[model samples]
Target: MTGGTPGPPWSWVWGAPGPPRATRRRGGGRGERPAGHSRPTPPASGPAHPPPLYQAAGRWGTPRAAVRVGLLCRFAPPQLPAWPTAMATVVAQRLSHLLPSWRQAHQEPQPSGQPEPVFTVDRTQVPPLFWKPYVYAGYRPLHQTWRFYFRTLFQQHNEAVNVWTHLLAALALLLRLAIFVRSVDFWGDPHALPLFLIVLASFTYLSLSALAHLLQAKSEFWHYNFFFLDYVGVAVYQFGSALAHFYYAIEPAWHAQVQTVFLPLAAFLAWLSCTGSCYNKYIQKPGLLGRTCQEVPSALAYALDISPVVHRILVSPDPTTDDPALLYHKCQVVFFLLAAAFFSAFVPERWFPGSCHIFGQGHQVFHVFLVLCTLAQLEAVALDFEARRPIYEPLHTRWPHNFSGLFLLTVGSSVLTAFLLSQLVRRKLDQKTQ
Candidate 1:
């Protein structure tokens, strides 16, 4: 009675609530029943109902899209003296919209539960540029962005664009390439234009890209050469893209046979392969990465020597844990093999169609392989991000700023998605032929 409910909890007190608070009374005393007698299912307690809001992925949050936007906001340049508090307020409110009725937004619990919920955070829901997908891929670290990026200001690092460019580009190019391949008439050149340019542009970009990095560090004179080459490579990409789609526009019916489509492409190869016709005046002979045949056609102009050096370095076997030089040597071997693959396929030969060029049947598979390789580079990027984490005074924070950590996990998930789709697509195509 002192606590308000004049009768005992099990006394069938229905709607007699002064306030809802924990009420306890000695269960053994004044029960008017003998000890050990099964307490008759202590009538009904509280409301015989569950709360209106349901538990999902642990703490209840508002709509998912709102959460992703909150994440993107975390990367904004350092706030002015008057803004951290202001920005904090706004971010908290935005997060509140996502937190379900069961949980408060932005308020992390004393100890978050295990098997955290991975939400579908949409960057668009938060603002002017809504389409960008900046979901928190992994766990947010227990620190701020400043604590994560380390740099005083949000300056883009060397590998910033390198990683995002491929990631963002992959979405668009992968789709385009897949469609172009599907549209092929098995013989027609017209519809297969995108693929043609994609290969050329990819090689040209890669060649110049590799050249740019390797020489940019050597000297300014060499730097200029590689820089110009990089630009020229971009120009080639533009041409390849347009030519791939419409080069044979004037002769639509000619694309009826896949061989006809690709044969003219073989001519284009002559253009790509013959690169080193001019001496570098500076770069040594046996040259770093190019061919020198002035007479060969455009299609066979470029060589594939440098890319292996880069691709192998990407997934280098752990140098610290593995035999230190073994990883480097393994990468070296992969590098040369990739280079050989490129040179053999792109380089001109007297054997022409009968040579190992016939072995280049898995170019489509290689495209997927490229995607996997890029993901590996991204994992390295995340490692870099993790390494830059800051030393805060154990701030009173809720969520951690483990962006890189979350990103690595997300990469794995994407790989799984890719594997499932790859198998399914292969099955469907294989079944159609039988």
Candidate 2:
């Protein structure tokens, strides 16, 4: 009893081992098992090593490099034949190191609610040769979302494209509209009524488009109605402006100038009626909606996961409506396309002859301007600099835009240069004041 002394407290017992068992730790000796009986590892004192990810054959960059290594490992001419197990162990060691780094890094807590560190993969990189889908497995819905978006040409996407396309178009038109409202257009044209009407229509369309985009995002009923209205407005302007082209008509005593406004406008309305009634169902569930359209989720991993606060700011809505007016800008686009078409199709003046028939006079200048506008529209579509969604990405997507800009600059400069040359040759002297 004296030798034994006092026993352990109440928690301890005479016969049993301790409550918390000791993990089996590896002893530093020959034929030792790894600690905790978890995973195995090569002798720790062997040498420094790269992570498993760094050693992956293909991971070293380029399939050829990996192929070269694998070929050497398996079929080398010399006596460098290593057992598969040994090779696998070495490779596994490297990957094991790499796995811990990123996993641990992401485990680091941040104010943002995300659990893992977002991979800031550059979007412009060689479009993930394979295995990209796994990257954004969490945001799979975004795949369907963007799919619904791009399929608009085939079917309506709750005003996704209609609202946004037109909104973007409006911004472009506003650029042109501003130019017109400024001295360049107002000073030169004595007949400002047409210009004013045209500009007003543009502004109205922009407002409608933006409203449609926002409201439609809220519900399907709103989406359908807003989309319908948007289509109507589009057709109206298309036909109205076409008729307005010949608006430089002699007013009759009885009617207000017999400008065949009804004809073109009616054509547009008829198109809407026919389209809405005939392809209503088809347009709603367009065949292309879930078709070949794919996002390759890894494509914009960085951009899509950007901070929400910055996103809110850049897409700032109008203070009046609390929306940044991304939707409103679309109306401007509708106006521009319709107006530009009208001008190109009808105007037959000395300064800006638009029609094909009005050949001899200064019609060439208008033709050139129309071409420039078309090119600008195409450029905007390709570049989408204003949208700038990439700013929110974990990584940047500026390269595609850089390429797009170069293409636009080249195309526009060439078109402008050609038109100017033609203008210089065809200057009807004082025909400019016409």
lDDT of 1 by residue, 1-434 (tens): 23333332222222222122222223223233233342333124323322222222215343233233323333324311234566799999987876674474455543455444222223232222111112212111222232233331123322233333333444554555465457444356333333444454555555554445333323323333554455445335433432322222112222233323332343244223322222221233343343343223222322221222233345556546632333433443444345445433433322333332222222322333344443332223223223312311121122222322332332333234334434544465467569
* Model 1 spans > 4 angstroms off: 1-159, 166-175, 182-195, 206-215, 245-434
* Residue range 1-93, candidate 2, lDDT tens digits: 111222221111111121221211111123332344423233333223322322655446643354345445434334233345578999999
Q: Score candidate 2 by lDDT.
A: 0.34
TM-score for predicted model 1 compared with the true structure: 0.21
Tell me the deviation in Å of residue 216 in model 1.
Answer: 2.6
lDDT (C-alpha, whole model) for all candidates: 0.34, 0.34
State the displacement of the C-alpha of residue 175, model 2, in Å, after optimal TM-score superposition.
1.7
